[model samples]
Target chain A: MTITILFFWLSLAGTAVFAVSGALQALRNDMDIVGVSFIACVTGVGGGTMRDLLLGATPVAWVNDPTDIIVCVTFAGLTVVANKQIIGRRLDLLLWADAVGMALFAVLGAAKAQQYGAHPLTVILFGAMSATFGGIVRDVICNEIPVLFRKEIYITAALIGGVTLLLLPVGLDDAFKLSIAVVVSFTVRACSIVYGWSLPKYG
Target chain B: MTITILFFWLSLAGTAVFAVSGALQALRNDMDIVGVSFIACVTGVGGGTMRDLLLGATPVAWVNDPTDIIVCVTFAGLTVVANKQIIGRRLDLLLWADAVGMALFAVLGAAKAQQYGAHPLTVILFGAMSATFGGIVRDVICNEIPVLFRKEIYITAALIGGVTLLLLPVGLDDAFKLSIAVVVSFTVRACSIVYGWSLPKYG
Candidate 1:
């Protein structure tokens, strides 16, 4: 029961931060409040929606329980209100929040897929997709190249986390395993950000 | 039984034409052969996938039956082989084929949603999404503004078709109603292409 409650709050936090990141992007592009909210909501739920759709899970997460959408709209409004304070540092803050959200969702997505009996390869794919696809959609909507397809070591971080989770001993407590996975994913992403690490581009 | 076969063939044709359109765009962008095929396959199935996901129809059409993917890949290859022959008129051909595909899919999407007991408004939304999302994904992957959001009369055409189908007498034959809806959508889109008709832009 405690573990379930912990996951619920963590998922809410992840949704809120992702919403803020999307809203910041929309504001940067000079979109109005409606566009900002739309982007925010889509970014918050997009990854899990994609995962559920691929796994034949119906009524998606948001449609079944709209807490995610409500959180998205609330955070989007908050971001707009706080716009002035974060003006110059918006991009930096967005990246950090996104990293945290991505890390959390990566493990969560893999866990959900595993419960649904997806193949091991599919679990890893869903993990990376749930971590990166929201940002990809946000960038695409803003008419930019998706960061996932860029040279950034983004999806790789999620894949590493997923593999780590799958490789853990079955005897370990679920919560402990999940915590380790999230930490591993976040550390890789944080290091990449601070060190400007990237994969080599094709010639 | 005959109606089912007609719908099946129409769906295949729509998939093929959409794939061709996506491959042409990738080729114009100088994408490699693999990239072209990837874009083609995504574009061919993207719209229907979006509709199915939103309507809580899982295992999506392509996953349940791989026929659509097969058709998309075959058409992508054919487009590559015919590249030189259609170089100069590629854009025109793509637009025409896209219009037909969009019209066919719009009615089909609406019909599917109706069968699933979706509300009228939801049915119409799914119809427009099914008609335009493939092109939207294709443009996004290529880092261009989606034509659906351009001033073009794209979604409007699909909406009109969906409403037409819904308003038809309940006594009408299913195939006849679908045929009429497809024609209406196609006519609207064809006129927009020929005369450059567009929606009014925001001031």
Candidate 2:
């Protein structure tokens, strides 16, 4: 179906963005090329892998296909090669790309979880997990507390996007649902990036 | 059927050892009780969770059955409550318990991966994954470099045990094979602790 193809493209794009974001984090931590590649690969597939495992989808998507790994390595390699040129633009680009990846993944993850009959709350959590777990893994590996547990507006955007996906009216086509979710999530993330928005921390 | 019961006990014991080891590591980082519990839970289930996910076992064991979580919490809580009393013997106890965990998980993980028909080499790696991943995750969350990747006898011990599990001759009973693997791994670890052995590190 056309919906499948659209989701395929969205997943690929989201994966690439996540890979690049991970490589950027590696650079920040002064990890070498191998470190960059590993982080990128983990970041790209980590969320989906977790989602699939939690959903009990066997042979995990990436392990069965290997294409996702290939995509991750390619993007990470590109980041390593372009390291010198990306410094000044790195922070800005990283946030934008992370937001894009989060939007796409949040939608896709929620959809997959729903298809698997996850509780609505679980589906929303899956969306957030898919969008942000890679970053958490990356930060943890690099000895930084996970950004997700920090005061960022990070998980909020994913949760909102997931809820939006679930609330699609009965008659809306899948394509319409997907695009609207991506846009709404991306916009929220962008606003957060631009305005330094964050959730309040409890003492 | 007999083998199932044996492995059930092995898995529980391994899970407990991993939990205790994680709580000890959390203590080293000056984490509070909640932090200890969290780290212990992650360490206890992290490897099996990864194994099940990688093997496509749905609902991951812990999620479907809260027993593992309960065990992890109970052990962690005990560690917290007994903090003052156990410190003197912790070093010796930690090493021995960790060895037991690594031994059991390595055997179980390799066997499971083999059951799924993973290549021999991949099975060996899976065993190592089962043994050391929890510690790696534990250290990462604690903002420390993983001990497995350092100049420790840690991963080497797991790798050896995994390979031993794989190379068992065709006729050995499963129980005998499991015991040998665990013993071989524990002995190697014990020697390392007694002799201060470590793998050579590259600059």
Candidate 3:
């Protein structure tokens, strides 16, 4: 189905971006290869796994097939090998990747829930959860405060994307819904990153 | 089946102990009431939920049944309101409760995995994951390195208990298996806590 294809590519992009973000984070924290691989795999599938668990979709996406986890591990390995140039001097690269990954996951996650017949509100919740929880897990494991809890506008972007996907006309194609969701979500996040925009925080 | 009773009691004990541990941890970190309840619920069911997800069981246990989460939330509320002598100065009570929870989760998690037909190795892994991961999530959210990561000998205790449950004679009553597992695991942990035992960490 067109929906499946939409999810397939969006999920793929999300996984790739998430893996890079995690690997770069691990490198920054000076974690060894094992820790890097662990963080990468966790970030890569953590959201989707949580989404499926919430939906009562058994056999969590990666456990039913090790392929995605394996890919994530490989990406981590590659990042480690290219540490000096790609991850070291390019911290901004990791941030952009994280934003893009967050965008894709927000759309894809809500879409999956919709396909499973969840209500629009539930879809929005699942989408935001999928978008942000991975980064939460990653930062938490590294012993840092979660980004969402900090000044970042991460949750807002995911929520916008999820609501946008839900409000689209029913006559629209699934692919069209997914595409628009990404554009809006990614643009919001990308602008935030570039402009150093952040939500107000009490010091 | 007798196994059902074993799980019922162990799960009850697990939920209670996990709730207390979360509440105590929250109080120590100066979290407000909402944060306290959130951490408590997450710690209370985080492990078993992970176990079911890994086993491809859907709807997660608490999502399908709200009773456990409600209990955890209430415990958190009570801990916050009953703050003075019980939870404030007597951190030891919290540690003891955590030990009991670790023991129960270890036994019950492995037993459930076995009942679900997981491999022997997987049963052990899942049991350990179920027992310790809740604490890990708790600590992470509180912005501290997990007790397991630092020097508490937590993983060792959980692994010993899980393997003990797995190796118990099948002909024995499930309740007996559960009891022996608890005794072994709880004893080890209590000793470690009382004696200030810790695993060496490289700085």
Q: Where's the lowest-lDDT run of ten residues in candidate 1 chain B?
A: B194-203
**Higher-scoring candidate on TM-score, 2 or 3:** 2
Order of quality (lDDT):
1, 2, 3
lDDT of 3 by residue, A1-203 (tens): 66676577779879888988888887777665645666787788788878877777766655435566667878888888888766446467777878999999999888888888899998998899999878888877877666676455778889899999988898998788789998999998887777766877678
Q: Looking at candidate 2, what is the lDDT of residue B83?
A: 85
Q: What are the lDDT figures for the candidates, one per model? A: 0.82, 0.81, 0.79
Taking the true A–B contacts (Cα pairs closer than 8 Å), what share appears in each candidate?
0.17, 0.31, 0.24
Worst 10 residues of 2 chain B by lDDT: B146-155
**Which residue pairs in candidate 2 collide?**
none
Which regions of candidate 1 deviate over 4 angstroms? Answer: A1-42, A53-100, A110-128, A140-145, A148-203, B1-6, B26-42, B49-87, B117-129, B136-203
Q: After superposition, how far is residue A99 of candidate 1 from its true place, in Å?
A: 4.4
| Candidate number with the higher DockQ (1 or 3) | 3
Candidate 2's C-alpha runs over 4 A off are A117-122, A149-152, A167-169, A197-203, B1-45, B57-132, B140-145, B148-203
Q: Which tens-of-lDDT digit does each residue in B92-196 have in candidate 2?
A: 676677788988898888888777777675676678778877877887777767654333466667767878888889699988888898888878777877887
Task: Report the C-alpha lDDT of model 3 over B42-134, residue by residue, as the tens digit.
Answer: 999888887877777766777778888988998888888888857546467777878899989988888887777666655665577788778
Q: How does model 1 fare in lDDT?
A: 0.82
For each candidate, how many residue pairs have backbone atoms clashing (under 3 Å)? 0, 0, 0
